[model samples]
Target: MSQSDELAAQDAGDSGDGPIEELAELQVKEEARLEKLFAEQREERGLDDETTLHTFFKLFDMWIQLYRLNKCMEVLPEVVPICRSRGGDFHVKGVQALAFTLWKKSQFNDAVKLFHEIEDLIGCSAALCENMGHTYSSMGNFDKASEYFKRALQCLDKEEELGKKTGDRAGILLGLGLIEDRLGRFEQALASVRESQALFRQRANGKPSSLVAKAGMSIAKILLKLALQEPDDDKRQEMEDEAIIREEENVALFEVTCGEDSPLTASALRGLGEAQKRRGRVPEAIASFARSYQIEAQKDAFDLLGIMEVHNHLFGAHMDLVKLGNPLNRASFRNYLPTVDLALDRVRSMKQDANAGAYYKVAGEFAAFAEEYQRASKLLSEAVCLFKTEDDSKVEGLISHCEELKDFCDAQLSAVRGSATANVSESKS
Candidate 1:
């Protein structure tokens, strides 16, 4: 063979008759391996690449998990891009998840922005509108929340024709119930939740869904709020009884569906704890609250609130014991005061309208009696302002007490001045 031909043959042999085919094959293999790793990670975290209910739920779960883990930035980029690429059901779900994550992180403005984006994209869905309402409500924007809740109910009404096909009537009803509760429409809330419960019963042959437990909890919470709003002892007792029944139902449902360790189970247990506290069953309430708090720490806001409430109840129980001249209870009262104060601080920070006024009132009274006069005055002012805005008849006694305290302080000041002047006159004589 000629030298040039031999050289060409050698080149061909070196290249395998092409330009680095093996290198290209190796690059493809590497890409596949990386892709596999990505898929595995996604699956491990309960996320999917497609746009289906399962995928949406997986994404929701992942979003919640990431949010709880404080890994928002890590998951936000990956999910947002996928949502933008696949604009449909997945987009709506992504937006909802993003909004919830933002809300959880206390990014209210960003959460509102994502909520609006979802509303624009999907026109109106009951779930989206309800969630937006909840976000607004949490931010203390009740007017806007009410507006969104109305829109959600409208959406549900419009889609009523497709109820059989969608199989989400109960969900829509529950969403409406939540909105009603937020808006302080307790009767309406109860009606909606009861309707949802009935629908679930019909569909599941009297078996409650996990969703029903949530609805029951909502109803129970609303009932408790209503009881708080009532002045008449009999009426309050009736409402409390109703709340207890609803809470019991929620606990039973959670026990049946979620086992002991599930978050819902913890929540239901907490609801029972709250009911017990209101009924003055201190020991039972403490046990339930402790169990719920143990299931989840400060991760769940509700759980945190429950723990705080339990501490407050314990403080009250100890105070009662002290009043009965129990030395042990007096020691416990002193030891728990700081813990109670911490819990109250957390509850104040949450700024839930339902509890804010009460917390402020309690803090004001505690401060005044504890000789923290300046703090007492500020907290009392806050309580008065919130109670005025609340428009509940039940706060009349509290308002009256605050006014009496203000007047008494002024009188005491004048008396002190008079006494000081008399002492000066005596010294001069």
Candidate 2:
């Protein structure tokens, strides 16, 4: 059978197994098949041949479709010599693919450099601006991201005027909204996101597609934030209630569309947890956070920073329970220590000094509250070092505060050890 037919047959014969897992496995198999096919073609035609380059492009696209971005990174360098010699269009396509793959792989700096190269070659298009916007947003450069998103919107508008629809308007609006939200323009963010959500809904024929779910989630989160800023108690409560309902709907929608085990579902759950926590529903919040943690932690390419954030939430929720004098939650501290340790280890491995510093500081605060003074001091010291290395204006104050806290924790640890040693000596005497 042909490859397409074989894939169709496989999909048709899919049993009652996990749909997301099954789909992922299918993609992996397809990627492997393509790789093998490409190898055979390259061996026959050699790298510089037209047929081999065609196969190379096909393989690169396949890798992107399968989210096997690392594979794209591995092969791009090998094909660069041939692709550059072919033509401007060919080289542009290859470079664009590499940049996009790098962004997907979280190598933002390298991705930006390649993106600039693409712009230097062919000038800016809506798609190029959109990709750059996304990459900048990922790097936390909100102002630059906003500029790119606006540029993309302008390009889209020009295209629309020319009667050439690209169907990227909704996504661009959503991206702008996200950047505005980060920049604290909440009202603008809300309006943009709501408009984007409406567009997505219309595109989906009022159905729940992934785009609609994402836009809905963004709207819900903005509403939750607005609720926090509301002056009137009644209006705040109403907004909070609406946000919670929207979150719950999004969670259900994600479970149906992306599977319960999907990262989208986990993110929806985490948002729901945040909403619940805001409403002082500690136990419910804990359950939601725990479920989110479970799903995210199981993924092979899990977002370590996201997982750490979830762990922090879980720790906070558990600590809240203990603060309320819940005996059941007291032992939960012991259960959480290992998770905190694991998260900190992963953060250190990430080599993002600022992010690692923030995580360490948070972990240290939790450890200090748990009376694990020694661990707290160590964590705080690491944070101090990291913060000191950064060039932010606030870093010096943060470093001093962390150092002060670390001193307190060290003193507490020493006192505790001294008390224990004295008790042992008395018993021996």
Q: Lowest lDDT 10-mer window, candidate 1?
A: 1-10
Per-candidate clashes, comma-separated:
0, 0
Please, what are the lDDT tens digits per residue for candidate 1 over residues 262-345?
A: 555666777777787787765676567656655543343333444545445545654554565755433333333354465556
Reference-based lDDT, residue 134, model 2: 68
Write candidate 2's Cα lDDT for 113-141 as tens digits.
98888789988767677767767887888
Model 2 residue 45 distance off true place after TM-score fit, in angstroms: 5.0
Residue 309 lDDT in candidate 1: 56
10 residues in a row with least lDDT, candidate 2: 1-10
TM-score winner among the candidates?
Answer: 2
lDDT of 1 at 2: 7
- What's the lDDT for residue 56 in model 2? 70
Q: What is the TM-score of each candidate against the true structure?
A: 0.56, 0.68
Model 2 segments more than 4 A misplaced: 1-69, 79-82, 137-146, 205-208, 249-266, 294-308, 328-345, 348-429
